[model samples]
Target: MQTGEHPQLQQQLMVQNSSGSLSFNSNLSKEDEEMSRSALSNFRAKEEEIERKKMEVREKVQAQLGRVEEETKRLATIREELEGLADPMRKEVALVRKKIDAVNKELKPLGHTCQKKEKEYKDALEAFNDKNKEKVQLITKLMELVSESERLRLKKLEELSKNIDSLQ
Candidate 1:
């Protein structure tokens, strides 16, 4: 009845004869053996079930890992192929950019030249306009002088005719 002692051991201790000799109880031993056998059988069955479940989970994890590795390899191959294809286009893009830069450099000087030519044309046009204004003024002055000379010549002709009549 003390704490921590097995029930079978307590029972065996109580079954001692008054002569203080230990008496063997075959019935109790057989019952204890049968209970031990039943407990051992249940434990073994549970252990086997746990082992089978562990194996099943391990197999599933391994299969998933294999598939993941295969997908990763496929993606890597695709990336490599895309990079390979892009290399030529990248070079072509660089070449086109260089050509555009060269054209722009050439156009810079042409733009300046065009601006210079346009300024020269404007200056020449201004000079031509000034000369045309001067010509118009000169033509007006010439016409006025011609009218005055004609009046003087007419007055002198009238005076000479009077002098000739007096001499006749």
Candidate 2:
């Protein structure tokens, strides 16, 4: 055998005549050929079974992924519905708060005006009471002056009458 030459598998063929020589035949024995074929057939069957099982597993995984996708979509829809349900109340609360702010804005100026008008009414009432008191004082003074004038006139009339009787 050479250093780089690989050994070959063969059967020796025996010749009956022709100097009874032996020659290497390239084909294997019948029993060895049958065994090799049976082993190759078994390997092919196992490969086919593995491939079928792989396909089944792949299909199952794809189905599970599809179901997960659908569930995720449903969860998203539910979240949207929940947000929708809460939005109206938020809007209503915001509107009510705005109305309250507007009312407070109106009330501030009105309250100031009411206070101003109340002070004016109080000043007017005080002035009216002062004028009434002044009127009462003036009436008392007039009554005193009338009484003095009447007494002086009656004394003059009696003096004049005595003078006229003496002359006659």
Writing each residue's lDDT as its tens digit, candidate 1 over 22-81 gives: 555465566555554554566568879999999999999999999999999999999999
**lDDT against true structure, model 2:** 0.72
Winning candidate number (lDDT): 1
- lDDT by residue for model 2 (12-131), tens: 111211246533334556654454455446656887999999999999999999999999999999999999999989989999999999999999999999999999988998998999
lDDT of 1 at 112: 99
Q: Which stretches of candidate 1 lie over 4 Å from their true place?
A: 1-86, 158-168
Q: Which pairs of residues clash in candidate 1, taking residues 3 or more apart in a chain or in different chains?
A: none
Off by over 4 Å in 2: 1-93, 158-168
**TM-score for predicted model 1 compared with the true structure:** 0.43
